[model samples]
Target: MNNLIDELTPEEIAAGDVAITSELVPWHFPMMNDNVRNDAYEKALKAALKNGGTVLDIGSGSGLLSMMAARHGASHITTCDFVEMVAEKAKIITARNGFADKIQVINKLSTTLVPGTDFPERADILVTEIFDNGLLGEHALVAIEHARKHLLKPNAQLIPCGARVYAMCIESSEIYKNHRVETISGFDLSAFNQFSSYEYSGYHIEKSEHKALSKIASIFEFDFLKDTKDESVEITFEVTESGLCHAVVYWYELQLDKDTIISTAPYLPQLSCWKQAVQLLPKPMNLTKGETLKLVAHHDNEAIWFNRL
Candidate 1:
């Protein structure tokens, strides 16, 4: 996302107008609106439509993927999203791209859709951008589970066919400050850490900010096309540097197709819609270069928190 905080006036930020305007206009973020995401989608969609049939785009935001499917010679495309306003906007977007006849935008959850009524038939291909920071946080498991059981063809091609979350142990006092509330002007308020959220944050950790103590480790993986179950993951990584480790710096890789992959890993050139997400340690731990750190992930609903086993 662009650095709007620096551009906006202090009054706008204080009045919450900056946030309000952000929601009012979602198309401004270059992270999602630019060619980085679209290029990956185009390549994968073209490959999927080599022998095209009906394409189903779950969470088809702004109808871009549907238009891409239409361009790739799909017989028909049914794009669906739960948001009514977004669905309506998709209709207008599809029309502007001159795929109004080939694509239909439906405003309903994927689970509610039925064959022979809402859609003419089960989808031959399932294309969706349903992953979150941890790869499962956006109800992707439930959505894919429902689709495999009811909506998709027996052998449908699932775009972003799989994903894997990679994490590294890091020691960053600067990063910890965001979540930790210590004394401010001589008041002991460390108890506020109990109320601090463990949710993955969209924090941009610069290269200079954090010191990596361990090699990157893959914590979790999901294969969307196959029968899958969500579960917590445990990982152990050998520390490469000695330091005070404070957080798990994490990101995910998207398998758009067999031949294509997109990611938001640190220092990568082509990034996806997601920034890297971090899971802060409850307490800092000192470590050595040769020692290992064991990480146990606790998953509830779709969120994850990493801690010592």
Candidate 2:
């Protein structure tokens, strides 16, 4: 039998391991995007220090935000993650940055740790970098709500209190053709077209503006602090041209406050985990130059959601 320690990989140890009813596996593995995410954290930290309150980084991956909180002159700080390895590594990172004494690292989910109860004190500001392209798909709202209920003070601030999603049309003729399996060795292999339009992942498509394509829809934006947790949103978009509506390119801009805004959508210089969630519309809506494209964005109960046009 493989012991937990002996079975673990280096990445597993650094990312944080979790245990279910039957087995232990790594979870919340930190894939830090230094370009987009780190910059957002820096901006959020600056905003958080405006109030000069105690801070809590709900998912303190790599302790980057916690260290930023200390540097920004936060009075006190607590950082937690459900993954034990991540929390432990965050402590190391904080110590290396000379913030070990200012920030307390906890290895537990936000729900399991209660401020002024399990935690040392209530947090005056709750900061987290748990956002995905469309927000709720990553369960960012659920995590923030958990921290708000158990760990935050009466008027705690939420970083990126809200986010807006923008989407447009894209074409990938090569991608669709690559998935086509034709006759091989005198055998018919055309059955693979069934998955031809599966555009769940990101790809590098040469930027082009075909007159046949235009914005098809706008998905519902998310307000992390004010929206209901059990809600699924659907948005419809109109197609302005006639062509194969291959995919919907999505991006987001976050509103940290009334005055502070940051975006990582197309045309932005940096790319984060949100590298434009492309939804493969069911069929290439064959239309003329004036036909409208209708797209509906939906969020499933399990938090895995997508937009369709």
Candidate 3:
């Protein structure tokens, strides 16, 4: 009789290997924001301790959050990640912390993990720190929605119950010139313009506090338990000051509650994977200095992709 837990297929092994070895150790795409995680962990632990039930940590990058939940008196802890290497490392870390018996690590995506089927049961508390800089970059919403529908108990508590995308215009000639200008010193290197189109590059904001160039835009929202509707949230921004809108500067603000919120904007002096998702105009729009850029943010809930128009 072969138990499901002991059955590790070749496909699962390959996926795990690629995610852990490549994503977790050296090139962590969604870099851990320790401050955010620490804050969320403390809050979740308090909630979990009060409830005193099993916990599930999704996207368990290094098993730190799961371990915290276990130590905080969660009846049991289950951690899952799509990346194999990260899961392998997390297993080691969990075992090393003497929680091997109490905590289980599964190398699978949250969407595929079923409660009572793949896991012991529906976790009472679901804790995942999969947020990106502006709550749009990581698959946080997708993972949360999937878990809530399939793996979480009816009354399960979701850490970071909801999140918002906060963004405002900034004046950064340095970043614009860096991306917009193609040739310099008599070189015809226009072919290098492709890098500017890629949205992965993190930008530098000089000031720690920023005045609203326009009102802040709310790109998306996620309430873990409810059915998430699909519709593009349209926010139009009139460029008051006419510099190149190299891209819309983006960041994230988390609503722990009505009173407690954690904001990780570029001006906040914190490092996070939710870097700026810039949508540079295909052609640089030269405003007469006061021309409004009229930026429209388009969000697709299914694929979890956000783009500016």
Best by lDDT: 1
Clashing pairs in 1: none
Better of 1 and 2 by TM-score: 1
Candidate 3 local Cα displacement, residue 144, angstroms:
1.5
> Per-residue lDDT of 1-309 in model 1, one digit per residue for the tens?
249889755544453444444475353364457587788888999999998889989987778889989999999998898876667767877886799899989999998999889988998988888666566777887788788878888988888788877889888888788788888899989998998877677655664388989999877777877666546777898899999998888887888998888887877665456767887877788999999889786555466678788
Whole-model lDDT values for every prediction = 0.80, 0.65, 0.65
Instruction: Indicate the TM-score of model 3.
Output: 0.77
Any runs in candidate 1 off by more than 4 Å, and if so which? 1-21, 24-28, 298-301
What's the TM-score of each model vs. the native?
0.88, 0.77, 0.77
Residue-by-residue lDDT tens digits, candidate 3, 186-243: 9877777776544434554543222335445656666656766665665666556655
Candidate maximizing TM-score: 1
In model 2, the worst 10-residue window by lDDT is: 21-30
Error of 1 at 248 (Å): 0.7
RMSD of each: 6.3, 5.9, 6.9
Model 3, residue 208: distance off in Å is 11
Give lDDT: candidate 1, residue 291: 90
